[model samples]
Target: MSNCKKISLSQILLLVLDIILILGVITTVIVYYNTFFKGSGNLNGLNKFIMFALLTVGITCIFFIILELRKIVLTLIKGNPFVWLNVKALKRISLECFIIASCYIVNFIVNFGENKYKFIYLDSKGIHTDTEPIIFILAGVFIAILANVFKTAIEYKEENDFTI
Candidate 1:
């Protein structure tokens, strides 16, 4: 569509992402406060280590994802969405997703014996599941494949430019 429309859509998306990232940071700070300052020694060393690691990696990935999305949106605003740099950004975002997914799996395995899997919640009220990491893994693979498609498209566009 028009440049204005493209920027408007991306700007909306960027706003939403910014809000989510802010909320995530706030939640993470609250969690850390409750887990350490007010934990009353309920959490062990290993659990604390894992929690910190998970949050660090998760937040880092989120930051990188937002950066990559900003790059893509900027390209869209410039009327050039299929560029080599966008491909690299997409690839990096995909790798970040995989890394986050692996962290979740590691956390699950580390807590398997303690019956306290962070990804799978089991409470007296009911059984709640957090399969977000798995979904992210799948999304990562899909995005990686999409990046390849973008690479091919870029190559084709270059060839067309040369022909013209």
Candidate 2:
């Protein structure tokens, strides 16, 4: 744990955010311009629009998640990881995760019932699998629990301070 302080995580997260932003722009363009994607499992017409919307929302949520992570990392750097701001940030991140999960799950469902290709691949590649919804949903639940733990920690710290 002591060795971990030598590295700057905030900068790493910032770099990650920058990458996500760049990739997000490229992905948004690709998703919006269905013509660019000429292959099976590609979206079109109303389906394209729906996919574009979902992808936009998912990217936006991820951007916000990184922003909140930056905030939390800043707090950690300040040697105060149990602050209320972090709790709020964690709660926000959890909510964003849930929203992203919902979007992917919706996309999954929308594509599942259709005879045509969906925004997310439900088949092919010699296997059938979709992990986004599960991953985000689990992240949401775990982060929410962590937020509660932080809240409780803050309450305990406050109580300890007052006892003196």
Q: State the local distance difference test value for candidate 2.
A: 0.81
The candidate maximizing lDDT is 1
Give the poorly placed runs of model 2, Cα more than 4 Å off: 1-42, 114-128
Clashes of each: 0, 0
| TM-score for candidate 2 | 0.75
- Compose the digit string of candidate 2's lDDT tens values, residues 36-78: 3655265568887787778789878988997788788778767
Clashing pairs in 1: none
What's every prediction's RMSD, in angstroms? 3.7, 4.9
lDDT of 2 at 51: 76
Q: If scored against the real structure, what TM-score would every candidate get?
A: 0.82, 0.75
Residue-level lDDT tens digits of model 1 in 80-151: 999999999999999999988988887788777886655567689898887977898998999999999999
